[model samples]
Target: MYDFLLSDEARVLRSEVRDFVKTIPRQLLLDMDADRVQFPKEFLAEAGKRNLMGCRYPREWGGRGLDWVSTVMVMEEIGTLGYIMACTFGVGAELVCDAIIRHGTDAQKEKYVKPLLKGEIFAAECLTEPRGGSDFFGTTTTAEDKGDHYVINGQKRFIVGGEGADYFLVYAKTDPHAKAHKSLTCFIVDRSEGVIVDYIYGLMGCRGGGAARIVFKDAKVPKENIVGSLHGGYAVFNTMMIPERLGTAAMTIGAARPALEVATGYTTRRKAFGREIAKYQGVSFQVAEAAMLLDACRSMAYTTSRAVDAGVPENEIRRLVSESKKFITESCQKVVHNSMQVMGGIGYTNVFPVERIFRDVRLASIWTGTNEVMSLIIASEWYRKYMDDRASGITRDCENDAVEAFAEGEKIYE
Candidate 1:
């Protein structure tokens, strides 16, 4: 299915990424885990030289001019290393760079997007507030116009890379009375302003990149720093949401792959009741089930990426994105859970990374819009198509006899 979904060039790109990740020192990953720090500069520089940081951007701006499939390939590789690397180098770049490349003027693109693609500048997305999570419609951050500049004031909570980011891709309300989706606006706010960052929140996992809260107390931002248009936050968000879902799905599946391998190895070697754990059908079946689910999700993610690359219609793309996000993230959560069960005692302990993988994958189902939100999107889309078709007067009128017979046999109910 991957071969059918991904082009030959995309497959080659995937192989290249896998080979690069294979040579990354295990100690490097271990140190990253131990130190709980952002990605080392050396790694980022190497990735930039290899064109992995900007794989999806056009070639005119120091990118490789590849499509989203190539981006997913790199994301999977980074996810294999750890969550911080994936967020900083893969997810962060996609979210920030995509917006700038699509909407920024030439000057904004040169200053922010190009350098970011080359890894000269790192960007962090600041969308969630102290009162906002999945519901980003109620952000209290306000960008007040002051002639040649705008003054931003509010606090952002749980912002990824809030403490150390060179540039912040922030969302602030510019028109409170506009429609709910369009009332806010996005900006490329530099850290030199009067922005105060505080590192206070810690989580069960993904601690390396410094997820902190930022307060902009009358922070001055140039009027030119606004991304897209004033009161156009929805457009900015809509442009990147699909890519965010697709990239996140790929990352989760990649992180789960190692857990699957560890569980398989443990079951084959660990002795229980004078036989290997693999001999127990109960344990073996769990591993087999997990493998299938992971494979299914992987296929869906790659397919969605390819569809996006082919420029599928908006309705179709939305359907695929919602399905891919829900399927891949939810399956990752289940697969990691089964892996822990297969590892038995060691999985629950810090001796293994399975527990960490488990916690990290759970965040996927919640991030980039929760799985529950995905369901709503899917249902709404399906209902719209159904109603549209019905309104078009396209209905089968001669199935009454068949419907009556089926109802008589099965007692169907609505």
Candidate 2:
């Protein structure tokens, strides 16, 4: 039954990850949620030792040399721990290591990627700034090019791993006078080089791993640290978004699973009117809906990951990825909320894990590009594809079939 979605190898990797997750003490998980355990470097180091840090990266870079589908399996299992742990793993393995693998110079890869995959150092992507939220190209951070170095000055807010990162993949404006997409550049900046962790947020959920505001004031970055070509950060940004968004979608599957399980167990055992609560349509129906939604999201997430592995065109990937992230995250919220509802008031308190999962799942829709932004991208990409096909005289027979069934006079819009 699972053959189409997962191979034997992927299933084995999933078991391995779950085994590792099982070793994490319940107190440690609680400590993380309570904000007492910041960074969780020890946990990450342990994952590194197990060679679970970067399953999809090349073997030479300290990874297992697996495919994107394998990485999704790992993410899903780690996601059961909570959003904080899942995101911390993603920051180094998916976002930072991926950027280096794609665009970093040999020197940069040697210096950063290997250590990153080994969990020797953490990294953060500094893109969102104080003035702009999702207006990535509207970044006011400046990287003034000198003969041998670039002087960077600006602040990035809500940077995951900001407080503990050893290095940052930062995007800054290199040519303010140029078009928004053409004016930007990406750089690898060491945290020791005059970068400041201005503030660590007091988050409502998804705490731990140190999300913070970071300031780079007169930081001198070597010209060699640039990723890809000068003033070509836009391409790099787009490239990273594919994994960033998709990884979040996969992680949400794991996060929501625990909530569903808790609710299922409680409703089955807990009695109401001398029978199990699960016997009632009111409670049982929600469980059924949550199960269906979770399966759909999981299938879409894996399908998108496989497409990524196959190296589909970026624009096509963008549409499917945006759809997956938006739908899965939103669906996860519903699943968790429904789980809480099925358990009644007990699910809302710390007495159960459902409450914590509910809070943690809220951020998935908002981060890695807001769901609204994902919708915008999905619609824009669809329109662009439709127009391109029309301009190229390539008619889609399925679309034409619907038009053919309607009388010409009755086709009101036309």
Best by lDDT: 2
Clashes of each: 0, 0
User: What is candidate 1's lDDT per residue for 184-271, written digit by digit as tens?
Assistant: 9899899875888886445666665557788999999998999999888889988888777888888888888888888999899999
Give me the runs in candidate 2 sitting further than 4 Å from their true place: 1-4, 389-414
lDDT of all the models against the reference?
0.79, 0.88
Instruction: lDDT for model 1, please.
Output: 0.79
Model 2, C-alpha of 389: deviation from truth (Å): 4.2
Q: Give RMSD to native, each candidate.
A: 2.8, 2.1
Clashes by residue pair, model 2? none
In candidate 1, position 328 carries an lDDT of 87
TM-score of each: 0.91, 0.95
Candidate number of the best TM-score: 2
